[model samples]
Target: MKMDCIRTTAAGLAVTLALCSPLVAQTATETDNDRLDNAWSDIIEGEGQLLSPTQYAALNNLAFQAAAARVCDGEKLDSEAFGKAVADILVDTETELTDNEHMQRNAAVLISFGTRYGLFVAEANGDNEKDFCAVATKLKAEPGKVPLFLK
Candidate 1:
């Protein structure tokens, strides 16, 4: 009888946790995502130079992605696609500087920065262009979707 009660109690507890875990997990996920998003928003709202250490690496990821676009695109960099990417990642239009001159200048600065990083990626992958380009192509196929390599 004691063993039966213990089993029932354990099962009830498991069921309760299973039901409640999603709500708990969802809140945590949203909080973490919002934190990163707010950080990005703040960065975009002001001068874009990144100064502090950050747990979110997406800003740094721009360099690698930009480099991949530049080096792996072969004959010409897809400026349109890359520009869209830069805008999407680096600029928060709502918070971005309203002055046309400053906005353009900042955009240019980010492009130049990405180009520099592209050079770095290219230099580092001098012998690995084949593989790097392949990955870049895969990413381009599904802009926001998970890459096959990730799955």
Candidate 2:
């Protein structure tokens, strides 16, 4: 009876460990950078065709710079640098936008990016979303407002 009880406890422990091992390993091994980088790279590759040549080039440049910045920020060897790179992409898209609608959309994208990763020190410090929307709305109301608003 004693031997059977010990065996049953051992079996239960083994099963529990087996079930939890993968989860533990995943949590211990995986970092936020890995997920961020993967998502950003996928977005750039999949959506590159949608952008104009100028926009694509600007975004690519920003992405490259942001990657270097993230490497400096991330402490680990496999740290993912996607989040900041995506923010840079949004900034590039914002800069490339000629129309009010596109600017507003890009601003919203930037705001979302900032909200997600706390990017763009200046914009994140200020009320970037509200400023962007206000500028966009003003530009829509008066086309002449575009230059001033951007300025």
Scored by CA lDDT, what does every candidate get? 0.43, 0.35
Candidate 1 C-alpha lDDT tens digits along 33-128 = 222334333333343323111201333334545566556655234566546655654454334465885567566656545543644374436655
lDDT of 1 at 131: 54
TM-score of each: 0.36, 0.25
Angstrom error of the Cα, residue 30, model 1: value is: 30
Candidate 2 on 83-136: residue-level lDDT in tens?
444544555543455578677767655543333233322221343333323323
After superposition, candidate 2 runs with Cα above 4 Å error: 1-41, 45-50, 73-100, 108-151
Q: Which ten residues in a row have the lowest lDDT in candidate 1?
A: 47-56
Which numbered prediction scores highest in TM-score against the true structure?
A: 1
| Residue pairs with backbone overlap in model 1 | none
lDDT of 1: 0.43
